[model samples]
Target: MIRLVLLLLLAAGPALADRPRDPGGSVALRVLEIAALEARGEEKRVAGDCLSACTMYLGLSTACFEPDAVLGFHGPRLAWGLPMTPATFEAVTRTMAAYYPPRIARRFLDDWRHTPRFARVEASRLIARGEARACD
Candidate 1:
């Protein structure tokens, strides 16, 4: 089952860190971390559990202790859930916005804002903050 695959992926790592209280864990963070780990070969067990923890945490539900089960739910959400609630989606978006340049931020936000769940109020605020529209 897909659930089992997710579980194995998450369990492939160690105990995950608490979701950042302020930003919460964002999807982008998970992706970046996964890539970072993969680049480091941490996906392999012999490399230790850091990547596993990162992977597991990335897949976790917003709130839950079970890394495997929690992340199982997150995988699909990652693909389908975009322009989610600013409060909920902020962690990931903010991380990308902060770490990357403004042009990149604008492009990223523009595309993501087009998603169904993107809040108009949030979009307005992001726009006012100089988040350029990719098509602009």
Candidate 2:
């Protein structure tokens, strides 16, 4: 009986170990969580809308997008949900630039700076720009 119990426990170990944890909201926290997932050799597939901080996942080499995937990029603000100040926006832009490739980072910094809303990026454009590949 003890051996059977141990066998069951061992059988369940891989599934439990592969379970994904919630990626938190903050940029700092999500970055760490993404790093952990990357270390574990996990793939991040963006099928639907990936907005705001979620766009950070585009930085990961293992991340792929579905044909209909949409990514929304905007300047980051305070956790209190207040409007973004110049300093805060600059800081967020710098952080994002560090993560994203040069062309993608330039688009966010130059094109979307004064958009006043989330800048939507479709999978086709991302692929065309060499930012992401279509998911299998």
By TM-score, who's the top model here?
2
Query: Which parts of model 1 have CA positions greater than 4 angstroms off?
Result: 1-84, 116-136
TM-score of 1: 0.26
**Candidate 2 on 2-100: residue-level lDDT in tens?**
999999999999976664322225777768967997899899887667776777887887888876777777777667877877887788678866677
Q: Total clashing residue pairs per candidate?
A: 3, 0
Give model 1 RMSD, 1 decimal: 16.0
Lowest lDDT sum, 10 consecutive residues, model 2, at 16-25
- Lowest lDDT 10-mer window, candidate 1? 67-76
Per-prediction CA RMSD (Å): 16.0, 11.7
**Number of the top-ranking candidate, with lDDT as the measure:** 2
**Candidate 2 clashing pairs, residues 3+ apart or interchain:** none
- Cα deviation of 43, candidate 2, in Å: 0.6
- Candidate 1 Cα deviation (angstroms), residue 10: 35
Supply candidate 2's per-residue lDDT for 37: 79
